[model samples]
Target: MVWAIRGATTVSNNDADEILTETQNLLKEMAQKNGLAEDDIISIIFTVTKDLDAAFPAIAARNIGWTSTALMCMNEIDVPGSLKKCIRIMMHVNSDKDKKDIKHVYLNGAKVLRPDLT
Candidate 1:
């Protein structure tokens, strides 16, 4: 079976360290919650709000030893009144777990983006 786990987090600032650290933290939490290993991950797509330009979230994955997993980074659509300084992720993985059992994570300011999930 295949599953797509969703997650989002926000950085307090646009600093490179802040962005990278927050992204790594979010990814680790998602993996831990879902019982995921790097091998189980097929790919990850990350999107950042227009205001965040300090770093690429994919680099966080690589820093965490996700060298073999396919990764891409993009800009989130700029919508009026949308969340800012947010990094959203969609991780595709090979999993045997039921869809309903999968966990989605939202942290920091991004928690407001998905109240039901957080």
Candidate 2:
């Protein structure tokens, strides 16, 4: 079965290092919590708020050695009162795990995105 997992995180800057580090952490946390291998990931879509455009979030995935795993990064709509400096990711994976068993990671100030899961 294919499972879709979602995670959100916030970064204070548009620097490559900050973007890469925070994104890497979020992805690692999600994979670890769900016991996902690189092969398990079908695709990943990353989005950053308009306030951030220093780097592509997908570069973080490659920095973490997610070779052959599909990745795309784009800008998120800048809605009023919405979270800023945030990068969100939706990862589709092939897994036998149940929805209830999946762990969706919302880190940093982005925890507010999914307070129920946090």
Candidate 3:
């Protein structure tokens, strides 16, 4: 079966290093929580808030040896008064676990985006 794991995190700043670091942390947590391996991942789609443009979140996955996994980056639709410096990911993976067993992670200021899941 295929599952789409959701995760999000916020960077303290708009700097490239901050974005990469936070994204890596979010990915690591998601993978650990879901028992995911690079081979199990089908793809990952990342979206960043309008305020973030220093780097692409997908680079964090590549830096962690997920080079074979398909990845894409996009901008989230700007909403007035929304959280800033946020990076969200939807990772598709092949898993035997039921959907209800999947864990969705939200960290930093992005936690507000999915308080129920967090």
Clashes of each: 0, 0, 0
The most accurate candidate by TM-score is: 1
Look at candidate 2 and give me any clashing residue pairs.
Answer: none
Candidate 3 to truth, TM = 0.97
Residue lDDT tens for model 3, 39-67:
99999999999989999899999999998
lDDT of 2 by residue, 3-65 (tens): 889999999887889988999999999999999999999999999999888889899889889
TM-score of 2: 0.97
Number of clashing pairs, model 1?
Answer: 0
Candidate 1 residue-wise lDDT, 1-118, digit = tens: 9999999999889999999999999999999999999999999999999999989999999999899999999999999999889999999999999999999999999999889997
Quote each prediction's TM-score: 0.98, 0.97, 0.97
Q: In candidate 3, which residue ranges exceed 4 Å CA deviation? A: none
Descending-TM-score candidate ranking: 1, 2, 3
Model 3 lDDT vs. the true structure?
Answer: 0.94
**Winner by lDDT:** 1
